[model samples]
Target: PTFGEWVKYGLPFVPVMALVVGLYFYFAFRRRIQVKSLNISTLVRQASRKIGPMTRKEYITAAVLILLIVLWVTCSDRFGMGGPVILCIVLLNIFRILRWQDISKIQWEVVALYASACAMGKGLEATGAALYLADRFVAILPDFMHSGTGLAMATSLFTGIATNFMSDGATVSAIGPITVPMAIISQTSPLMVGLATAFASSFAHMFIIGTPNNAIAYTMAKDPLTGEQLVTLGDFFKHGFCILILSFLVMWLWVFLGYWRWMGFINGSVA
Candidate 1:
């Protein structure tokens, strides 16, 4: 029911993703980008002007944020991320960094949507629906077992496309159950398939409804000059298509270079 394992399993793809995304953005946006020259003194003056000086509450909040980050990074296994976050929230409230009114203003519906998706994911696994989907996916692939590279590409492509039409969580929930089992049946690494699927889910930039983040970004991009939406659906899809292709290429390169092997995911027998 949990896909948390995919995060650790997907670490091998991190560098590939970083390089590809960095290079792509650099080339694609370099022309329109402008840089302002500044020295240390200028930076200091600018910072002073913009931020003035931090107050006691700001310092306290900064300390809490640092503590929360340390706990999340170093003690996630022992303390868990949620505990530190809850503790920070309590501290913030008790210290008056945040108030009940601010907390009440949060959109609870978003939280409920996430909770419902997780519950549904659990149900899919519990009811064996995931396995059934895996079998079907494997059946469709036919000779995917003999071709690890092909399987990875196919899975990533499928996930990326599916996420454009639905929420990332829902797409992952529907496909994650199948990814690992399909990999196993194909004589490939389940870690590879799971990671591929999970990463692909993050490329949901084509549709406003694809993921909450996309929706939020679209909503925030109101045209200041013309009072219209800043980006159209066609624009999003066009950009997303390019990024999707780039992401797939990066994933393919990671597999080809045996980066997963360096991460101890690929053994001699498993592709």
Candidate 2:
């Protein structure tokens, strides 16, 4: 889905998300989480240490980053999602924003891990496991739940659950094609279902293998970016598990409340 559509689609739910954040802070404080285990380190890098007016290099870097985001959002279909990343890297080096030493500092192991995980996800797609899983899911769901609205919720929740085991992008790539047709078969708006599935893909909170960000976070404990422990695997799972449940509820209600239909993302009735 386009960024504009996603922004408009979920804008109404921001208050609910804010309240959830408030509750999180309230509970965390009540539990003394901030006192007991909140480990924060000085994030000062070389550029940040030079507390002065914006430098020309800094402006250039910031501009490049903004352009990178725009390209990623607007040109993803034409260039594929990974294209912007590669282009951004090259541009950064060309402009001296990042040099060979900076590149050398990167943990190649993490890159390898992501590449392998993506390969595995691609294999699942090639083998048609996505379709097989969908068929099995529909077969097991009750007859009544096969309707448009019910199927939307079911597909979303299923997508959310599935995403925790694979990268979010891969999950979307694998399931988007299937859910669109399934939505049509169920007399639902294919666009709505497709959007729901895409959003659900971001619910990959339970496993490091599910997303590159998760994997990188998992490595903070041992990656030497920090001299001490930053996060343990168990800690990641515990916090992420809570976030995952929250996301599932919010997503379900977002659709259940007719937000998609109201926003014109769903054609015809949301029924």
For residues 1-271, could you state the per-residue lDDT of candidate 2 as single tens digits?
Answer: 5555556666676677658757865785686554665424444554456786788888988988898779866876678657888988898899888999999999998677656656765665578775566566667778755756677777888889899887776677667656765676667777677777877788787788778889887776574665766777776678778878887787766655457666654432443
Q: How well does candidate 1 match the true structure in TM-score terms? A: 0.77
- What ranges in model 2 sit over 4 Å off? 10-15, 18-22, 33-53, 68-136, 218-232, 255-258, 265-271
The pairs that clash in candidate 2 are none
- CA-lDDT, candidates in order: 0.75, 0.72
Candidate 1 lDDT tens digits, 1-271: 1223444556667777778778877888788667755388988899899988889999999999998877776667776668889999999999998999999999998778767877877777789887788778767775643347567777888898898888888788777877777777777776667767888888886788888787788778887888798767787778778877777777667653466556565442343
Q: After TM-score superposition, what is the CA distance of residue 35 in candidate 2 from its true location, in Å? A: 5.5
Per-prediction backbone clash count: 0, 0
Clashing residue pairs in candidate 1, if any?
A: none
Decoy 2 TM-score against native: 0.67
